[model samples]
Target: MADGTTDQGPVTMLATPISLDFEFTPGVAQSKFLRGLERGEFLGQRCGTCGQVYVPSRGTCPTDGVATTEDVVLGNSGTVTTYCVVNVPFAGQAIEIPYICAQILLDGANLSFMGLLQEIPTDQIRMGMRVEAVWVDEAELIPSLASVKYFRPNGEPDADYDTYKEYL
Candidate 1:
């Protein structure tokens, strides 16, 4: 037995352990995309039936319900379909708070990827704003989306809301 101020058994407290060793084996589609990233290219797979393009490539097309094999290079520039200001900090977020995160539909690609918006104020970020990828330094190329530093405004006029509204 133990008094109120002392413990007779092991004392336990709630704690979460954090670590950084993360590794994975890529599937067929992801393996191809990773190879492309190593070569400094963006790879996409086109749906055989619907002809829709999926960037970062997929093993199968969701629309046509079939495997896609046609690999294409998505353009570096795209239009921001929608966005949000991430004022709240989150785990594993590389950038600071009050940054704009956006969904961009690259030219000639049907699917869009969510990425961080940079080189502009969060207040200036709007739907349909033209943007382009900012590649990471040449020495830092890797098999991941992190290869692209971020997307920034390209000084082009904003697109019509209706033009990309459905993408949202």
Candidate 2:
């Protein structure tokens, strides 16, 4: 232990840092979803059996284990199902601390997607808040979630809690 305290005797520990580089192949569902992001749009997979939609789907629905072959285009705006204010720092984190990370339930989608919420103070962020995607510049569009810079309030009325209670 770093502090050198143990019940029976002193314990020795080794610290190791290992890094590996590997290529990733996206599955059918992920390929489609990434393509939509490049076009500055949101895409989700619709499960045939459970009829639930998932963002960045795993090519199948976890609920029914059914192939989610249907592609559903989702609206950029959605309701904030829940959120947390991050105050701790970690490795490879680009955003500053004290930021809001939220689970947003996009319109027409059955699942919530995680995104960074900004343009509002942490104390002001609330559940059922209406928000919209803030995409990167057109030239920076890519096949990744990073294409959307962050989410922000859309100036609409707060959503009724009933609309997003299931997600919370």
Candidate 3:
């Protein structure tokens, strides 16, 4: 038997840093979504079986667990189903604190996605508010949602809660 002691023998410890370099394909649905973003478009996928549409398309029907095949183009304007006022700061966040992160239900789509809300007073922001995508210049368009700088009030009336209650 060995007693619990650190004086038994000399021990050596080594530490090292490692970096990762990898590449992958975004798959069929994601690739189509990214391609649409590059052209300043919103492409959603439709579940063949359930007929549910997903924005930034998940490539599958979450409810039915079936692969989405049909591609649907969505409108830039949408309704804010819900939102939060960000009062705390976190690492790697580019915008100033006290901003609104809203879940928007784009027109013609069945799902809602989160995006930064801008050009609107935080105190005035509310659920069911109408907003539209503010896109960057064509020259700056990339294969990413970054092309859509942010969503802002579209000068439309706020929708009733009942209109978007399912998303919330």
lDDT top scorer:
2
Error of 2 at 125 (Å): 0.4
Per-residue lDDT of model 3, residues 1-168, tens digit only = 467765666557655667799997888898899899999999999899888789888688889998898999999999999999999989668999889999999998989999999998899999999999999999999988898999999999998888899999
Residue 166, model 1, lDDT: 66
What would the per-residue lDDT of candidate 1 be over residues 88-153, giving only the tens digit for each residue? 988788788899989999888888889889999988888899999888887898888878889999
Off by over 4 Å in 3: 1-21
For candidate 2, write residues 1-168 as lDDT tens digits. Answer: 656455657447766879999999997789899999999999998998888989878799898978888889999999999999999999878999999999999998888989999999999999999999999998999999999999999999999998888988
Candidate 3 accuracy as TM-score = 0.84
Give the Cα lDDT of each candidate: 0.85, 0.92, 0.91
Score candidate 2 by TM-score against the native. 0.86
Count of backbone clashes for each model? 0, 0, 0
What order do you get sorting by TM-score, best first?
2, 3, 1
lDDT of 1: 0.85
